[model samples]
Target: MIESILPSYVVSEDLFEDPPDTMLFPEEEKAVEVAVDKRRREFTTARLCARRAMARLGLPPVPVVPGPRGEPGWPSGIVGSMTHCTGYRAAVLGRSARVATIGIDAEPNEVLTQGVLEVISLPAERERLRELARRSEGVCWERLLFSAKESVYKAWFPLTGLWLDFEEADLSIGPDDGTFSARLLVPGPVVDGSEVTAFSGRWLVRDGLILTAIVLPAPATTAGSPPGASPGSELIGS
Candidate 1:
């Protein structure tokens, strides 16, 4: 189901439930060793999803540990993200040569808790969400907005190594195209000699879940054979 929303170059794996055999490496287990049963289950299963994605990329299974900010630390030359919510867990990966960064998120298709939307959304974004709700029925636009911002932060952090607040990025959602655009309200990151002040991504709400993804591609014109090791030159399918 996750593959349906991503581009062809990305390798993705998702699971609706934790498998009985799910196991975590010693290093990976340390991150969740003290957590409750539910936290342990989700952390372990999400790594399982990530390793499966790694195998699909023709790479051997490796322990996926957390970085300083709790982001998954991918192997060298790999860019990826992991998300888990309720009954769903998913991971997506792409080669650094073809892709610069990747962000994917999943959330239950339910309206935001009262006052929660106001905390995560800008006034402009809230106004836009109201407009979107009028156009589309049966979809949780507020939750979708939160999910899109989560995805944007996932994609933003790895490149900038900095934090991005929900209020720092303004979003404009499309009611018809399953797409959204994010405009950075602060100084933007520069990739391959150009500043990226904006980003575009795709979203979907289906089967009681809301999924959002963002993939940025490496510069294709770099002098190196495969490509330069710099950040993305352009958004892929964004």
Candidate 2:
């Protein structure tokens, strides 16, 4: 479902259940060695999803460890992101040469816990979400907007290697096109001598899940080739 919005170079895969220990790579097992059973399971399952995505790209599965800030440290020639939630786990991978960056997020299709919408959303964003809720039936626009910001931050951090607060970005959602745009209130990331102050992405509400994804092409006029290495925000399993 997430693939529909991405470019052809990106490969995404999703899993609906927790696989057994047999799905883990040796190095991956070591990375989650200290975690309790639950964390370990979630981490391993996400990695497995990543490996399957890599396979679709014709690349072998490599241990996707945690970087300095707990972001996924993808394999040498891959740019990717991972996310997981109850009953769902997913990963999106793209060849570093063809895709600049990728960000995908999954959230349960439910309202945010009390106070979280205010904590993570701007006053304007909250007001817009309220209006969206009145128009869309059976959708939690608050959580959907939260997921959009999460996707924006996930993409922003890797490009800038800087932190993006939840309230720092403003979002506008389109009901008809399944697309949203984010304007960076702070100075944006510089890529290939150009500054990116805004981001655009696609979203969907499906099967009790809210999914949002962003994909940036190679900085130059070509298909394959990205800039220097960077890290992104750490996700809480999902």
Candidate 3:
């Protein structure tokens, strides 16, 4: 899949593979968990791949943990997010100083459908997909839209410490300076100084996978001290 560097983040994808025995123990399993072993393996592989990507940029490996509502907990001084789907995995890492949050998503070409597309996309977005379909045969525009939406969610949640519905964000994708640029249209006070905050980044397709990367502006406060939080307020990792 695509492995490319953006201004502030690195985006890459890998074919899903089974994790080595060293990564898991037999005792920590159940029947359902065993049934989803392939997903577990892919997630493990994605984490390793993400670490390698960060190292390439001379950043220290940040430990990741599951925060409230299942968002990733990046180590102090860094922020990042990851996403994976069947047969593919992707990760994004960014320097905390430059970006407050970063997210990447990848999808296989076949998992998206027209019906599924209708549910997640707006009318204008659907029209754009139709246009892309008309101009380029066999490209999975729906899947790309879904992946872009997902990437936006991952990037937005952490900084705002709030959950947003998929409909809350609008996306525009186009060619920019030799790479695909994605623009985000976010609703509500989540974004700084406006109801809609826009972010732009690049994406590409490689090896039958669609890869996307986005960099989010950092919050003004530190991890435990989110903006607008009064003293002793509960900390939520959005």
Q: Output the number of the TM-score-best candidate.
A: 1
lDDT of 3: 0.57
Candidates 1 and 2 compared by lDDT, better number: 1
- Kindly report which residue stretches of model 1 are placed more than 4 angstroms away from their true locations once superposed: 221-238
Candidate 3: residue 173 lDDT (0-100): 63
Better of 2 and 3 by TM-score: 2
Each model's lDDT: 0.83, 0.77, 0.57
- Candidate 3 to native Cα RMSD, angstroms: 7.7
* Reference-based TM-score, model 2: 0.89
User: Pick by lDDT: which candidate is best?
Assistant: 1
Model 3 agreement with the true structure over 146-170: per-residue lDDT tens digits: 8777776676677677876666666
Question: How do the residues 86-144 of candidate 1 rate in per-residue lDDT, one tens digit apiece?
Answer: 99999999999877778889999998899999999999888988888888798899999
- Rank candidates, TM-score, best first: 1, 2, 3
Model 2 Cα shift for residue 41 (angstroms):
1.8
Could you tell me how far off, in angstroms, the CA of residue 84 lies in candidate 3 after the best superposition? 1.8
TM-score, predicted candidate 1 vs. hidden true structure: 0.93
Q: Which residues of candidate 3, in runs, are more than 4 Å off?
A: 8-16, 19-35, 53-63, 175-196, 217-238
